[model samples]
Target chain A: MNEYYNSAYKPLLAIDCVIFGYEQGELKVLLTRRKQDPYKGAWGLATGFLHFGESLHYAAERVLKKQTGLDRIYMDQLSTFGEVDRDPEARVISLVYYALIKVESQTLETLEKNQAQWFSITALPKLMFDHETMIQMSWGKLRRKSRYQPIGFELLPEKFTLPELQSLYEAIHQKQFDKRNFRKKILATGLLKKLDEKQKGVSKKGAYYYVFEEGKYDELISQGFNFELKSMAFGS
Target chain B: MNEYYNSAYKPLLAIDCVIFGYEQGELKVLLTRRKQDPYKGAWGLATGFLHFGESLHYAAERVLKKQTGLDRIYMDQLSTFGEVDRDPEARVISLVYYALIKVESQTLETLEKNQAQWFSITALPKLMFDHETMIQMSWGKLRRKSRYQPIGFELLPEKFTLPELQSLYEAIHQKQFDKRNFRKKILATGLLKKLDEKQKGVSKKGAYYYVFEEGKYDELISQGFNFELKSMAFGS
Candidate 1:
């Protein structure tokens, strides 16, 4: 029995995360430089081998916390990468996860110590192995999800100006939307609460700050109200 | 080195398929009864252990073929289920996949020999080992994907009527769409070819037959056309 069990084929299970954060009208992905061999010193998605008796989600969260020093981040399993040669070291099946992290909420010291850095999605560095493909797939999923879900809220501060929200959407979809149309459609959803205070700086006429009303959003979702934004062309 | 490798912890990897088919105005999922000791004689998703050095997608396809005698089906990796106690027998991590197959295209002999059967999505049996959760998650993903992609076409016959297409959508979303609006919206996309044929069996006044034009759909998709049907309420 021991010999039979030992002879059975076993492949290493792993997890990789595409950590996305939005800031300054740009979409960024957090990446870490490989500190070990095979692709040492090369940038890649934060990844680790899944341990025994652990759930995939738990393993993903562990990797996220260990790499970014962020806990309770919003993450979803993007897809599994099981190409024959995805990892050169051994037969490794990677369950890739995409995480949305508020850029301001992360600790900079942890990133600096681990040689972790955020790069613009448009100008990503050469990633080791199939990490680049994972990032591209995550970006595609994010763009599609953002159209129907208010996932952009995960990447923003607790309270943000209307322009900041709009910029985040524009950065995500990689296109400009009509201001009036965008505001009218988004406001109709009733998922944002206009705060009493106005955001100072960045404009002579400060824009009003708005907070995402999770309770209202959940209520609307329960009632089957879908969130959709028209895919307006550039300069629309 | 061999002793060390053999002594290391290893978890069993498995693949489960949510095989979806549309027939008789209903969405159906293919299931099989477990023949082995664990959950013996209980209905569950068609599943198999993943072999060493095999890709996850390949494992899913192999399971589909072994259980249904189907090949080259439209399948997508839904997500990985890796809860520690998901499988009571062992530490099993299941990679779940959803497959779309035309009911008529399948070989029924293999299904009968394997004791595999199709159950309506609305009325499923007590599935074994977290299989119910897998089916529900796959259904959710299918409904969402069908909204923006012509995925339901995979479940229908090559030549179908307008009403048939409408029924497929209704069955998937579990709601009725406005006939006029659904037809108008679907036709405007130019993804269906109206054939000179008519389907007379379903109604006295036969509906005109239409075929999904895959090439046209692909072209439209490349040109940034999104497939969407308004989620009309029931009895609309």
Candidate 2:
């Protein structure tokens, strides 16, 4: 709306979100069918053009809400993609962001109305434009961040069993962790609070649910402690 | 320039480089004095507008070469700054990049010709626009990245003493590390090639000079090894 610079070249600005969600012990990404030409009906990351006078993060949040009908999810800027001809119809420079959402938060009816679906990272469909590249980069960010930060918790429910937490890590990293070793390393951080309540129907001996203690995690980080679970024994 | 999308709004695109260099046991950043009216004479990161059809990395490289007269340096995209009022003269979106260069590689004559100077991170001048925020963000990124990657080598000479390497890490992280512990952890990685030569200037007992084994570092990284130096004791 503001023509602040009349003579400078302006490239079209846009934002694309790689929204990750975990369900049934698998990591999945939310995608929407393109409604316009240039790739009509093709699946792609949830994306939208940036509105004038809006911050980049706000644009990403708006796009995520528009596509998934969910708000207040954990989101991070992955990187910016400006490959000149990345868009077939225009020279649109896009800022790619990754979001982690709880799968149960979105209703099936909303997803149907928006023509949105979740695809496992390993089995993604042919995406329009350079979206496949964006998804791959987002997956790398998630895997790297999950090792040092409790970012995987965003994909799981607030209260989760140790097994569920380990499953989420395995899904992101694409490698199974030794069950006993995983629990030991994670619990040793003293960042998880074990709830007296137990998860039902997951196992015959229901595993006790746990919640991440964000305050304690931050405090530990301030005191020169890093959260690293990468050394846990890897399973074949 | 190709006018592919005449109807869409195009924000001005630009790239800014936070070029970091190390010299005499201190870390410094390359800065230029603005020549135009918006922030004339103010110190800021070297930056330039993106040319039509130029990729983001190319534009950043061009800017780096132009300001510091250095090419093919180790650079990475720090982040994009798209705040609506980030630039007072125009609605410009900046893709900020951080570059690590060996200080001795640049000539003083070239720096004088470009009116660029290196400033210590601890004592930076008043920068124009939101360049200060960009520098702060870049420092955080450098610190975080230095912990998990062997990026500190980018700021050091090809053959460096163990104390020089430790000093570079100390400057970036703003903390002191235990001498014995730091040397043990770094040596155990086997990514440093201990040279047969010794450096005699700074200490009564000359220290051994070493060079980073980049090939081995990459090989180890490909095999799922992380380069971590955070475990060394930190000082108050």
Candidate 3:
């Protein structure tokens, strides 16, 4: 590494995971007590230093799994926090990634191992360093991602009704989307396949179930497609 | 700094700027030959290493000023590129920023320094070490920003006709937008202040001149407002 580069300062790179979990109909963020000396015992986003030759995705995934015993989470790079004093201890630059995970009872024991607990985003405890700003920005990023991406698909059934899908979005975004425009904007993306059977259950007129096609969705994103849901826009 | 951190590996941090300049009615990207070896003389986005006490914004601004002799440019963080082998010579993470600069005749000498040249984005020369991907992603980010922000204000006068503004958008986006929809959508944001007088002497009936109020625009963005322009539909 010394022979290859000529930079005077090598900042320690760390990956901080803002793990958002949908549990019991609430949006929660996972945090733990930092075991390091600078802000020891203070709550901070679950973070891990990156090793040489490690990809950022792998580093973030490794941290999420080690902290919560979860895998295969949906992750997106929110932003990089590189203020010189963001970390009081060292010149550390954090590459923050927001991950969407569904919390379940089964992982309670594993989460407790590292003193990691899920707290409602609305009522989070005091955080360490710039963790608070990172979390705040993650919310905006999450909202933006929800516009075109299937944000809650991991927590939804493979085949779900439009109403059920809208409910998940409303929970994550904390707003109600108009039923008519929500359906129209989502269908406009052409990523959902209309199933032949209608949803069975609570009412005489059951809404039809739709399956979100991942392959088509990926193509849309690749082409820089923008999907706009007019009524009850995100944060409206 | 050692008292603050306990990481074994310190990743060198660098800032690569995808400087987007609108010149001669075309979107151009600024690139220069890599001053350092392994890929010396290969075209790459203008880059600079971060100093220990410098903020990321300052570092990026400094690089931009040094490369093009321009200041007061609008900048945004696009993303961080940190693959294991993104830089063959070393393990370095590049915090990429995209800047919008209006190219003019007066700064030609400064741009010629260090062999920096403005290449049309569509006909970019082969770039070195993931710089091409950095530019590609900047386009998406810029497009999204243009939907809500004043993307071409620096190039236009404080008071300009709707046609002048629309022509700038079509040039930057490389496509045409519907006249009626563009006017309606822009006016809907309320960021544009309608001036009392219309354009003079061009024709029997001249278009009204609207002033884009930056103070109002900033307020709207602070509230996490998502502005949508329905007509022309951006990339549609």
Task: Tell me the TM-score for chain B of model 1.
Answer: 0.92
TM-score of chain B of each: 0.92, 0.95, 0.83
Ranking by lDDT: 2, 1, 3
Q: Write the per-residue lDDT of candidate 1 for residues B123-185, one digit (tens) a residue.
A: 999999999999999999998888778898999998888888889988998988889988887
Real contacts retained, model 3: 0.74
Q: Write the per-residue lDDT of candidate 1 for residues A1-236, one digit (tens) a residue.
A: 23333344667788899999998999999999987767889999998878887799999999999987878989999998888788777677889999999887656887788789989999999989999899999999998888778989999999998889889989998888888878887787788999999888778989999999989888878987778664442234
Question: iRMSD (Å) of candidate 1?
Answer: 3.9
Model 1 clash pairs are: none
Question: How do the residues B15-57 of candidate 3 rate in per-residue lDDT, one tens digit apiece?
Answer: 9999887655577888899887778899999898888798889
Candidate 2 — what's its lDDT?
A: 0.86
lDDT of 2 by residue, A1-236 (tens): 23324555678888999999999878999989998777789999998888888888888989988988778878988899989889878778999999999888778898899999989999999999999999999999888888778888888888999999998888888888888889989998899999999888867999999999989988988986778775662342
Which rank order by DockQ, best down to worst?
3, 2, 1
User: Which 10 consecutive residues of model 2 chain A have the lowest summed lDDT?
Assistant: A1-10
Error of 1 at B69 (Å): 1.5
lDDT of each: 0.85, 0.86, 0.80
| Candidate 1 lDDT score at position A40 | 83
Cα TM-score per model: 0.94, 0.95, 0.86
